[model samples]
Target: MTVYDFAKSVVYGVFKPLYRVEATGRENIPAEGGVLLCSNHIDNFDPILVGMMAPRPVYFMAKEELFKVPVLGKLVPHLNAFPVKRGMSDREALRKGLAILKEGKVLGLFPEGTRSKTGELGKGLAGAGFFALRTDAQIVPCAVIGPYKPFRKVRVVYGKPIDFTGLRQGKGSAEQATELIMSEIRKLMESSK
Candidate 1:
């Protein structure tokens, strides 16, 4: 098995029971072709939890510093993670993201750019919208509900693929696209209430 598959199995094995995690609407994930999996970030394990429940392998763009840590740095790469310089227009990171989508892979992104301390949905950065506008990849909104406290049930809900047909043309800006993405995510979060 690939490292991603093995790691996913291991993570699912450990986190599912511990957190009593349940995933819904997994069928929303397109079985093939590139996919942009956008979600709101909560805890540090948000990425792990999302990846664990994803129907397909997901490649994430993590912060550049994460690749500098001891063992995690070396391991994250194998887990299909690459580093991106936050708080600026990191062209290299943007290029890498586009390439992943062009290759028909799932590029997971936390559109808020960082985890929310208040556990509330935050504004989405234009980066995700840029990718969406640039590629034909399916945009799938995901929401992770509940606290990370052990024994608490956490629900990871994947919403239906977004229809960006109108936004694809030269008429829509990336900021507009991002707002739409965030609205869909907000809807998902509200539905879980």
Candidate 2:
């Protein structure tokens, strides 16, 4: 089995029962083609939780520092993660994200660009919208709910793909697309509550 498959299997084996994690609407994610997964970030486990529940493997753009850590540096790459410099525009990161989508892989992104301190949804960065606008990838909005306290239930709700067909032709389409993406995530959050 691939490293990602083995790692995911191990993570699922551990976290699924430990955290009592549950997922819904996973089928909403397309099985093939490029996909942009936009979700609200809340905890350090958010990426792992979301990735584990996805129907397909997910590739994430993690902060550059994570890759500098000795163990995580070597491990994350095997798990389909790459580094992205936070703050300011990181063209190399953008290019990498675009390339992943072009290859028909699932690229995971946190719309807020960082975890929320209040556990509430925050304004989305334009990066997600930029990727959506630049590629024909399916933009799927997801909500990761509940606390990560041990033995606590954590719910992952994946919403339907956000339709950006006409929005792509408009001015500032990326921002508009990000808004819609966040809106759908908000709806999923409310539904879970």
Against the reference, the lDDT scores of all candidates come to 0.94, 0.93
Clashing pairs in 2: none
| Candidate 2 lDDT, 9-38, residue by residue in tens | 999999999999999999999999999999
**Model number with the top lDDT:** 1
Model 2: runs farther than 4 Å from truth? none
Give TM per candidate: 0.98, 0.97
lDDT of 1 at 123: 87
Model 2 global lDDT (CA atoms, 0 to 1): 0.93
The backbone clash count of each candidate, in order, is 0, 0
Question: Per-residue CA lDDT of candidate 1, range 1-193, in tens?
Answer: 9888999999899899999999999999999999999999998898998888998989999999999999989998999999999889999999999999999999999999999999999989999899999999999999999799899999999999999999997568999999999999999999898
